[model samples]
Target: MRFFLSVSCFILTFAAAAAAPVIEPPLPMEKAFRMEARRDGPDIALRWQLEDGYYLYREYLSATGDDGKPVEMSTPPGVIKDDPGFGSTEVYYGTATATLVAPTAGMLKVTYQGCQDGGLCYPPTTVDIDPATLAQAMDPAADGPVSPARPQSQAAFPLVSKAAAEPVDGPGIRISDQSANGVVGSLLDRGGVLFLIAGFLGLGVLLAFTPCVFPMYPILAATLSREGESLSAGRGFALSLTYVLSLAAAFSLFGVVAAWWGQSFQVALQSTTATLVVAAIFMALALSSFGLFELQLPSFLRNRVAPARGSGGSLASSAALGFSSALVIGPCVTAPLAGALLYIAQTGDVVLGATALFALGVGKGIPLILMGTFGSGPLPRAGQWMERVRQVFGFLFLATAVWLADGLLPAGTGLLLWSVLAITFAVFIGAFDQMRPEAGGAARLAKSAGLLAGLYGVLLAIGAFSGATDPLKPLAPIAAARSDTTTAKKIIKDSFQSAASAAELSSLLKADANGAPSLVYFTADWCVTCRVIERSVLSDATVANALEGVRLISVDLSKITEANRSLMKELQVIGPPTMLFLDAGNNEVQASRLVGDITTQAVAASAASLKESL
Candidate 1:
């Protein structure tokens, strides 16, 4: 009876098991995550589709070419998550694509890893693609990196960056198309060899006309004119060549060092003491040109020092002057120069960057070379005309000295010096003296110029007495307003608070909670461009109105102390004239950052944009 019960029970259990449903196994890893690759012109495009309950690790996804060299790639931002296996990491769900610069001509290889939700992690998988296959699969629609979906909050997505490399921290806010430096940098990275050469050289030619380069001309002219009748066209060409080469060398060496080391070496040379030293050099040169003294070695050491005057003193002096001028005098950072510096800083490519800078110097020197060669040809060879020419260059040297020292001098001293110079020039040209009836056309022209100089000098003197600072706008302070209460515009005082360090700046930024935007201006007393922007853009009526509700902060790098250096490094400030726009949350509105030159319209527009974003 018991045996019969057992058999019946076993049969019943078997029948119950046969009736139960079954569970299916998970799908293969390949089926869970699918990848596609294609050629997008000179670049490679990659796309991955993740099935539901599946995600790919961003750090695990990488690509390389047949040459076994890793291809440079840029991907969209991914979702941040804390994983049990990997701690905090970035991962992608749904679908996404990555863009890579095409590597050496060969097969493309891609590798990635994925994991199932609440389940096992898959091992890394590699996919090899033939170059021919990729070429045949070229997509006409995909020209660049596809824009990924981003958060709607302005504070979350400050700006979309199109840089080749992904931003490691925040959005990679850089000088863009609106900046000439950015354009040049872009060309350096993507343009053809011939195109880059022509473009940078042309840019150098254009920069030659700027105010920064004006002082160099007078220095070179004085050197050649001092050589007088003995200078041959070839000799003049040789001296000019030496000067230009030295200048180019200085720029290249200093620029590369600055970019590599992340410090403004040229800017450091603009300190008050340094400027005074350079001014003293110019003054000595001017006195020599004025026939006040000679620039010769002492008699005791002359024979031992140099054998030939032309080969030793002239060429040596030219070289020394060129190098010094490049360092201290022409410290302006134009677009092309900034571009080359940017490239060097980004790539750490001293060789190519130095070469480009050298080419730029050569382009700027073309006019100087021509002038040096032909300047002596027009001279009268040791006569009153030659003496007059020498005297003119002496005045120019004196003017250059004054300009250099202006920034370091007391307020209004520059205007006084200029007034004295103009008056002296008028006297030298016989402005008030009686002229003979037989005087020629040239004499009348000189008298006319002298009269104008005398009149301008008188104006400058009056303005100086009235405590004016700007030589260009001498009488601005003294000029009566149309109506003080009715027509006078509101004066905007310096509203910027100083930030001594990065920590202090951060605290200040966070302390304000009112939702008003903030403007952080990076400026330096030694920076000429900074002064101009402060005078023109920041002080504009429209800009001031736009920034009415904004908190203003200034960080002065003029002294370059350790604290300032740390602040600049943390802020990623390459040089002055850099403005940072911040929203109420203290997050940088990356798109609104300004580098190099700025205009009133741009400043106002940036402020408005920051406010709107907030």
Candidate 2:
């Protein structure tokens, strides 16, 4: 009787603690997901010591800069679990280790996601540490056994993932969730290699126009644009070739890694300090563009970094810069790339992933290659215009850095800093000053541009003072109204109901809605695309009007947990902004399942499909 009473009292206390709205002390990052490494002859021995009660998602295990390149290094098979959130996903509990066959002198960018027994799941995180640093972190047992390698099981990692492997009672085309993303993924699933390659290559060409690819351009343009002699077509060809090859290699490697390991670069390190490092590097490069300091390395550092001032030096520099840019800039996923990545994640096939990425890289580099070839014949003759041109690029780089840093910093801080940078940039561009009456067309244009910049800068400053976070919305008057709001729209928020746990989501999916259909919206803090949808499409009143009576289940993936992760897997959703629809009978309404960002009209049309009047 005494023992039974003691157990019952312990259970009561646990239940009470679970019921309370209390925040538990978080584990130190190092202890929670500690990364350690050691040298085993030419090989590198790496281990992640997960604290007790914390589990690592095997699919999230990632390796970067292994084998002297950003290759998609593999991990041993993990213990399988029928997760409540993501059914039949593999996970590693307590401790896990992997080996790199031939380690190189480069940054070891590791990414992994884990959850505690408390039900909190961390967003995918990345750690870029030197091999030496990792070695120091986990000193190998002086008498420890060398890490012996093991082969991965083919059955365990079949081409098609078991989560989606099971046949569902849905339309054949419903495999992928969104339009472009879903369509391309469906084609790949149908096994058309030529279609996949041709489509992704075209998509790559399109992605080149996006902001993510901008960082690589200035570096290459600056390199090719020397004052003394025009870059000969032959040299330009060689340089562009080297740059393209290196970039393709890096991106292809990244695709393979993402396929094999299931982590996108953005998902891996979004809002992390490593992203800040990339911003800092670009800031330093911007200083060089301003002629603050020569980019050429010191004599002693030259040998260590790259060859000095010759054809070989130029080629080496081009290749290194290209590879480095691909690794750093990390092109944001567009529809085509997202489709390719989706295919890779579901299949874990590095070969197809690498090929698609290679094609995409080639397409992205086409403009760079063509411009370098034909645009080199301009005669600037090393005058004032040249310096001005360099300064223009300098300001561009600074602006880009500020833009990249925006996600990491708080909204107010980002706008304030961006405004200050804009002011500085304007000063260089001749803002707050009139041009000489006899100045050239270009000079007059510069002054005109600077005048506009100055006006915008002042507006930004005012917006900052008034506590407006969005740089685009630089008005003090609307600040209070905006500050009082939350989510896409007040009415939309009311329409959407939050599902915090797997049980809740399962119930929502299973619950009978009489005759109404339900739409499940997936979102997370790190998902920028989700924000875009909210700001651009979902905010439209017509779109919201169409969803008047349909059930809206909003799943907050930011609060990561075992149950949540499993639910995402069950939904076959790789990341955020997934819209899953279910009919009254709890069957997934495959016809209207949208992935990523959809247009306002597209959403309205879908809603129109749902209305009884239709």
Candidate 3:
């Protein structure tokens, strides 16, 4: 009985140990700092050891004004230089070192904030170090003239209690970093390449069903059927292949141009001028669908349509036409095209861009090619049903035009434009419905309506181009652009504190001050998530209001020199947009280490929580 009990106890103990959760030491404050002063060169080097997933804001400085008041660093000079060959992810965890020419070094001060992945943030920390010691440690050949070590400060780095720190403005907290090496490298890896290809193929398939391509289906079907019984099956197949190849070529060319021009051109295409152009094209296509104007080949072009003795010329022409059509339809196929364009922009290699676009075109054309091979036997015979189908397609084209037009105009004007277009369509349809077959009056009326529609589209296009009217502008004003100087002033005045390094931040914790707690946001424009937060949450009035009683300071990370990189390391800031909260006396408190989802309630909750902590 005793042996059995002992075995049971041992088994239980083993199970308990296995089931226990593992705990890790707190991530080493995301940053480390080193300061070195050179006696011979009068150079001071500040090196920062940044942890993984956090980045230091380098452009903005935390400085004390002449009157010993905290001055927010809104703008700073210089650009943060990064090593290009370094992998982005590795760089995110790497160190940055900045060297400054010192007049006479006493102690170099550094201050920074860092964010963690788990959503908690550390208060701003500062460190002041002896540069001579750093210089000595870094030198390999020095044998003499060692600098004496300075006495360490008796006053410990201040630690503001969690209870004393002011509440942050949002429901959750965020840390922002701008180093892109990791993200870029991950995107360029083999797995990433495969993922991108797969995504492009999927989008190409989807584009086939869009208004941009759907209208071409009937025309393509009719043209294929017209090839007649004399044409061999092989010839028919060749023509179909030629057409698809043409489309691929055209798309490839477009992709090349997009890659060369990069983001700026893409942005322009999405802007007003491009929107208007798309609207015009859609309107023209809609008119053509309604049979108001036939989009036919010129009579002189009939020679080219003659039966070819060989497949080469016919196939090449078909391919060329396909290519041209691809270019014409490019702007209309925004979503899929945008993805391909982005891929091209990122790679900057024309071959990759062309290949991606060609893949997309093939995906788009495969169905049409298969349909052509089987001939019109697969389609319903042209009869009353065909007429009805044509009408449905016409309505679809009209709908597309209206949608495109909406993109060009402001909401109010865009709605008006759509309403007018719809009413005109209804009138023309009703007039045609009432007319007798012998009476040409219906045709004339329909022609008049088409003319009117064209004119209306032209006017709308002009308006969109001139910015005299915007159809898609939201009714509510965007909060980010609201320029209430009083609010801005109040927010700035509340969060005042002297700038210090990670070590100094530790020292400040011991000193107490009287005021509402303040939160400092260090970020850069290059950080993707930082832009997202600014566009989505920071623009919210409620979030901005929550920041009212608290001090909010934004540090720009783009300008941090090599010297500051060491300070960034000491602060453990791996990336941009690191948020740190401090009490009235500028001591560190609570911090939200990660940027959460952009939402009003979420941000409000973050603000409320930070306020409560204060």
Each prediction's Cα lDDT score? Answer: 0.69, 0.62, 0.46
Superposition TM-score, candidate 3 onto the true structure: 0.39
Off by over 4 Å in 3: 1-199, 206-244, 264-268, 271-273, 286-293, 298-302, 305-321, 324-343, 371-375, 378-395, 410-413, 416-614
Candidate 3 Cα deviation (angstroms), residue 476 = 16
TM-score of 1: 0.64
Candidate 2 lDDT tens digits, 1-614: 44336537744753554354432323434557666555544555556767787778888777667453554455777988776656788888866766565445666666777766544465567666555543211223334333244332222111221111233422221232343235445545554555556666777787776666776677677767642364577667667767876887788777666545555444554546656776787788789878888665456656654443432236657777788677554535455555566555543444555667777887888788876677656624367866777777777778777877776666678778878887887798886676678988987887788778878888888887787766777784565566876544323445677886667865665555465566778776556566667756776877777677777888876555666655654565555666766555445544565655567887776666555332
After superposition, the stretches of candidate 1 with alpha carbons farther than 4 Å from their true spots are: 1-185, 192-198, 230-235, 260-262, 296-314, 342-347, 373-376, 480-493, 545-551, 582-593, 596-614
Q: How many clashes in each candidate? A: 0, 7, 81
Q: Which one wins by TM-score: 2 or 3?
A: 2
Candidate 3 per-residue lDDT, tens place, 22-82, comes to: 2121233522222122332444434445555444445322433234444333222223434
Q: Candidate 2: global Cα-lDDT? A: 0.62
lDDT of 1 by residue, 306-360 (tens): 4555323466567777887786534676656766776566444465567677668
TM-score of 2: 0.64
* Residue 381 displacement (Å), model 3: 7.1
